[model samples]
Target: MIGALLVMIWLLVAMLLLLRRSQAVEVVPSGSPDEAQIAHHLLLDASPTPLVLVSGTTVRTMNRASRLLFASDDRILPPPSSLFDESATHLRHAGRNWRADRVEVGDRSVVALIDIEAEERTAEARASAEMIQVLGHEMLNGLVPIVSLAECGVAAAEAREGDSALLGEILTTLARRAEGLRRFTEAYRELARLPPPLRLTVSIEEMIDDLARLFASRWPGVHLSIDVQPGLCGEIDRDQMNQAIWALLQNAAEAVEQGGVPSGRIDIRATAGDDVLIIEVADNGPGIPPDCAHTIFRPFYTSKAGGSGIGLSLARQVVQAHGGVLTLLEPFPTTFRAQLPGAAALYGTGSVF
Candidate 1:
């Protein structure tokens, strides 16, 4: 009787276990992976651009292209904000250029990287080639005539006395051409040897006042005005700042003149925040053409026939050297803005460079 009871109890336990297994199987919906999930994985794997998914600081998933484009190690990827927020930001990984954008996938973030190294390198190579070409053309333009005339002068001096007058003329012409070439070369040297700013407390109001007067005297046809807050000052190299501002004003005047507007208007506005000083040099003229905007700041690029194209480029270099930025603003009122950190702000941020 005891043996029979034990068998019945064992059978009851087995039946309970079988029922639980059946319930567990029923809990899971019977289907393949969700279509959306499959499509998402497919999109990431198939994209030629590098893609990586991240959660917090940890990279959760990366496409195959990420391995080929960037380092296999994930630590090199920049934070999502740097990649997504700044449109001008360029990323370098594995000696290649990459640009990234952020995408949302439920609660996670995805970073999509595009390799732009080829395009960037090509642009740099083209610009370098163009610089070489311009240098050759300019040098030959002066040298060829100078050499020919020198040879002619030598022959004339040896051959006859009658050509003395003509020889003198050739010599004078040679001197003039040589002087012009000297100036041209000097400008390039100056650009290359731009001295670091001598940080000194400078009065913005005084600077603008001086600049306004100078512009008014120089460009009689243009109406120049200044609007600067009183007691505004910044720590900058006074001389270099003056030069950069002068270049900006000169460019504005030239643009206005080109637009052929009688009595063209140029407005210089200065304002300072707790951390930065903002200066806007604006003119009422035809704004920069969209196509040439990218190249205008490049060295050796000029739309003006007599322009050396060094002025604006040199000015920008100076501003950059001072840990500031100069950029042309878009839309109407044709403006170029210069943003410089205040002396105290620079010290606070430890961005003195």
Candidate 2:
């Protein structure tokens, strides 16, 4: 998208240059508009970026993109001053963020609106990928040698004669811990290397039933319930979506266990809209701490002792890969919601952390 935008900008610049050259060499008839002017208008209408031409505060003309943006009536545009601040580069309009750029064209001012929200998300995802690569590289370098040495020590201790029991036991513990660390590192690496999901039409009710059964087997003490709309189905990566939902369920179960709730309960609900699917998991446990809320979704950020801290982050990544959003809703009962696009609305959405 950015590359296409850059190409459009270059084309606009070339058109402006041609217009200047035409004005310098030729003159059109007094009552008729020049060929350059006609071509310039055509280019403006063809541009993907919303372009508006205004004489002071009054909007003189706008392109198709601008008309769609502001929902203009019969090609009539709203006053520029009302839509955006002339001095501000960033503005929120029509429920989206935009980077506004103004250019002077003779007496009229041309305002170009560039949607920056998607660009910002792309930048954030890039930063996360870089961070994961660097951390994984550094940690694995140190962990691999430690794991190998621990295994060698364990073997050596077991082979030694007389009073080797204590040494062997200590070496075995070290080897186990080191191996666990290696597995943890590999899990995170897999998260960083997650591939695009393979989508399928899945039954929401059956999926919820599976999750409920799994949760019951894992935490028999905690009660689990499901409330899915009948015939609720969506086009999604079934395995990825299941993993994401399981993470939420496991997180809730752990929270309930940690809080020592006498009567723990978890509810999984699924509802469908015209072009979206909403899945929510709520638990009656000691909710997330106020201070930890911001960093909870961050990879490897955990408050629990010996926690892998990969569940929530992995769940979020999977949902995002499926062109969806996984969010922790605020307040009590500790609900996590995943909003996903249905088949009709599945195009153009990209994955992000």
Candidate 3:
């Protein structure tokens, strides 16, 4: 009788086990494999751009593409609020052509995307624009001199003096414009051939102080404030970082020139949290115009009547090289932020690098 009871108990246990397995499969998405089996399936599917399947703030699973794309996070992904809260989502959709959709899988939310293609297209467009800016710069230089020459000829005609050298004025104007064009072309070439950062360990705080002092001297009228915590540093290319931050600062000053004091504030803050360092340079100026947000980082695309739009693009490239990111705070009191790893971490291809 005891032996018979034992056999019955075993059968009941087996049935309960089967029921649990069935429930697990039903709740799992059809397209998603068990995350445990991800290692063996790496080659089966490929994503062309950086893709991350972020569930809340945690990355439940990442395909090969995501691993490569968000490598710097190394171990932990950023907070959900950082990527897709109301503010981020609005900025994403407001002025850009990119898509950011939320998908429900099981009882959780996942963000799926191929962001790199959009990035590449943006880069290519900027490159084309820089080429055009160079051309425009050259043409204006030539035309300016010609315009001056024409003015001189008119003046000479009115003077009716044999010494009124119309040819001389025209030649001088043309020559001056030609020289202007040459200088503009030289600047274009330097931007085009900008070298990849020679990265090393450096304290970002020191860099900020350097910027503060330099800008204070340059923009005597503008207040350049710095609030960086102690012992915060990153593995970066100093020259590139300087160039990136300078671009943002210069843009901020320009944006506030016509606006009132409410737009005059440019704040730079850095905090070291856990193993990461996040830096922000914020301005209260007339934030990026809706249309400008989409193309602001593109090369040669400038909204300023006298500006060349290559700064932000270079900034983005520098950030990307550091295995980091630089993004505009969309619904902001007008801010730009950069997220980079701390000095101890070195970037790797499939990891954070």
Candidate 4:
């Protein structure tokens, strides 16, 4: 009887311990990371494209980019369906146009946002090419007859022994207009044919100083200041980069004049980054109108009367061909920023730092 009781008591203790272990296993704290969940989180966080997992309308979780984009505390966002239809539509968020898509991840849906800037650029390039072809066709056909007619008028007046002054004036005016149109079309064509940058090591500081002095001489009354980080340099096409900077400076100066600001100020600044060199041109002028912001980079879109509208477009094209980007910084309404890859980054030699 004593052995039996001892064995029974031991068995009872074992059962109790087993029961406690099972209960402990079942009671996982809410939201505790499992192997798969942790992996998904890491992948989403590392992805360049912004992503968010939504459980119905409430955002179950999101990566860093999502927080930066929404800028709101509410995790429960309006359904993606509201913003996007069956087809991927553009949503202007955070000052960029993004095409959002709904994707299924397990039972939940994830919203994937892709930036369409490159696509826009491709489209713009195609449109510019088409326009150039049309312009060339139209201008050639139109100018030939005008030139021929003007020549014939001048000849007739001279042969008839009549006063040739009127014909002379008409010929001169026609020639001037034709030349101006030719130059205008040529500018657009140049943007299309912007040569691949011939890269060479150049001091960015020198470029800044030179541009400032040149512009100051051109606009004697306007004040131009340069702030360049010492010992900063980049590998770039010298003449092309000079042209780009000159265009930016000229636009800023013109903006100041148009705004009619009493004390016009234009500031040029340069700084070196780990993998890129940044140059900024800012002016105290009436900034680009918000309404025209979308079309500002489009070829032949101009705000100024008599403006060819190709200056900014060409400047941007030149920068892009060099594997850099030129953008209008909205934070400073009249600021244009250019980011170009550093020499090390361009050549793949070593870290830019």
| Model 4 clashing residue pairs (backbone) | none
Instruction: Return the top candidate by TM-score.
Output: 1
**Which candidate order results from sorting by TM-score in descending order?**
1, 2, 4, 3
Candidate 2 per-residue C-alpha lDDT over 80-193 given as tens digits, one digit per residue, 9 for 90 to 100:
454345577877787898887888778777778888987889979986796677577657765777777676676666675646666666676767767776787797777889
> Which 10-residue window of candidate 2 scores lowest in summed lDDT?
344-353
lDDT measured at residue 162 in model 1 versus the true structure, 0 to 100:
60
Question: Which window of 10 residues has the lowest lDDT sum in candidate 1?
Answer: 344-353
Please give the RMSD of candidate 2 to the true structure: 17.9
Candidate 3: regions farther than 4 A off:
1-164, 260-263, 343-353
Give candidate 2 regions above 4 Å deviation.
1-122, 129-163, 343-353
**TM-score, cand. 1 vs. native:** 0.69
How does candidate 1 score on lDDT?
A: 0.78
Per-residue lDDT, model 4, residue 195, is: 83
lDDT of 4 by residue, 1-353 (tens): 99999999999999999999988885557666776698887887777777766664466337776766675444735544534343555676667788877887676767777888857899879986867775776577658877786887767677877667767777777777788777867876787788898988787777777777788789887899888877777888888999998988888888888879899999988887886889899998889877888777777667886677788888898889889999989734688999999633233343222
Find the 10 residues in a row with the least total lDDT in model 3.
344-353
At residue 163, give the lDDT of candidate 4. Answer: 66
